[model samples]
Target: MLVSVKELHQQTNLGDVHKEKPKKFDHLILGPAAGEGLPDRLQCQGIKALNKIHFGMSRNNSRSIDPVAFVTVFTIYNSTVESRPVDLVTVGNISYNKVKRSLAILNVFINFIQVNMPQSKVIILTDPASELPLQKDMVTIKPIQGEYSRDKLMLQRIRSYIAFLETRLEKLSQKQEQFTHFIFTDSDIAVIDDLGQIFIDYPNFDLALTFRNNKEQPLNSGFIAVRGTAEGIQRGKAFLQEVLKVYSSKFMKASRMLGDQLALAWVVRSNPNFNVRRFSRREAFLDKIGGASVLFLPCSSYNWTPPEGAGQFHGMPLDVKVVHFKGSRKRLMLESWNFFSSSSDLSDTLCLILKSGRTKYDF
Candidate 1:
């Protein structure tokens, strides 16, 4: 059966929210991405719990709820300063647009969990008053600081933001006196099926992160799970700082491209007790799975797969769990609409057109 991206998402569902007491330490926390319409399933408290597990200082010491089973979706946005967008859209604004589409994908994930995982909850962590429209299961908290650049300097800023949030969450932990785990997933991810197997199988690694082989390399930073530790948090902070130092100045001058993802790749590569897994195209694209609990995911259709394969990776029109329309490079151009319309339509007409040799799918 020819599966479109949206259909794959709808199919993966958990029977119902397990009434049998929720499991402990299966919570998720995601940095909220910019968007208006978000799905009820974007709840990834499980992913956030994984992040807390990897980055939080101590489970007992943290002021978070325990035995939480859910996902936390984090929004990782880059700045326009780092990437000089040739496309006329404002980099920040484009980020919001990208988040909108990504939110659609997250809804697909929510649907998957309802049918497949059933026991997971998804949550959002971000500014409470931001423009994005939020639904139930989403908690909006005030950021410690005001608006900051979403650029190369963004890594440092985000780390600080994370640290600040952790500190606040720690206070809450103290008040409630509960130990908890957290997982942080960016908005650009789609959960395909029951990925609980990964977390259940691998318990040694402090964190699990996804890596790409190269540009055609699968999803880099598509998903990561970190243990809450001083060392782990320190590593995340230090690595992000160093990466920002390089990219904020000379690195940008050299590559003229800002990749916070590369920084994450570096840290994961250098860390001990950190399991870095790379997902193959088949696993990444065809499988349609990713989350904070996922230690590794390949760059594929679900997260930031190029519309026509313009970036390093050339993806086939396989069933995509989520399509992350990365705003960094406006590869999907809207100008001359009809000319490119053939590429996006899910009908056989486009496929037939490509078959006729008028245009190749090898964009």
Candidate 2:
């Protein structure tokens, strides 16, 4: 017999159940409540209970997703002045301020995930030299140490990401219960909203990417989602392999600093199998490449970045989710975090600021 998460929560009194060891409950399914998705708080608590217990996937065909079926991954490395690119550093004698800033942003990012998406598992791939105090059941840290260079940084990230996904896919093939949706994002980002909605809204997509308004570098490589099913994993892996090939080739020598983004754009545009075209009236692009469906969502909502010269605190679009703190904007993430953390009603505040053709606050 199958038991819904809501039913199990009521029967077991989930609020106090976590105080002690939870009894095993198998054949659990996360069912929708009142034609709406389960509340984030309840889903999180249900995931906690389910983690302590053994539960199999429900055979029922429902649109609702299992709260624990997400695995978010991030890569961070402490780059010294020696390994850093000349153009990326300051003029005077170098300091570890850049690395410090990265760590700070990463802290905020992880905290946001812990608060917003507690049900999801987090995987951090970082250098062995750097020490991070993360010992939560939902968070895992894997050390990836190697010689750091500007070119090698992107290479290491792609290689590590691909290897991790492949390993997880292998486990799934072995009939092991693992996460179904994989989210790979950069460390220099502040997740303001739950990212699981992407998978829910756009199901069956092998890979999802965020695209900017810029024509030069349209696709942002910072946020990527890969569906973890057998075919989805295969297609996503194929796309990443193509990106790796492009990044490793001399074709991207002109802008090695932006190699990842450039390679992504090149693959999407140059690949004959990829049909890169905008959808009708919608700010989304759906492409079919090698029998895999790829979705290109607007960065304004999925991966928002504050405008240049904006003040410390700015109002974002009502629908803005993940805020990417790219380049010097990394310093502003703390301010964003502070605003988000203190706001009592974030949606209402953002709704008030959303004017016609205005996505961000000028002040």
Q: What is the C-alpha lDDT of each candidate?
A: 0.35, 0.58
Scored by Cα lDDT, where does model 2 land? 0.58
Model 1: CA > 4 A from native: 1-116, 138-157, 168-180, 215-219, 228-257, 266-363
Winning candidate number (TM-score): 2
Give the range where candidate 2 is weakest over 10 consecutive residues by summed lDDT: 354-363
| Deviating ranges (above 4 Å) for candidate 2 | 1-63, 67-99, 145-147, 251-256, 273-282, 308-316, 347-363
Give candidate 1's whole-model lDDT.
Answer: 0.35
Please give, for residues 1-363, the per-residue lDDT of candidate 1 as tens digits: 123324433533444545654222111111222111223111122112111101122223322222223334334343223433332232112332444433444454444334334445555544323334446343333343334344423343344435643563566556653332344555433343334444334543434444454543233443444444444333433433554554444344423233555554443444454433433233431111111222454343234343322122232233323333243212121111222233432222212211221111111
**Where is the poorest 10-residue window by lDDT in model 1?**
46-55
Per-residue alpha-carbon lDDT of model 2 for 1-363, expressed as tens digits? 335545756877746755675443322223331101222211122212211111112213223664433333343445444445422422112233555545566676777676656667778876566577556667778766553455566666777677777877898889887556888888766565667777777876899988765556778778888887888887888889888888888445643367888888888878575544452122766787655689888776677654421111233433557666665454345544554566644442222122111121111
Cα displacement (Å) at residue 253, model 2: 2.4
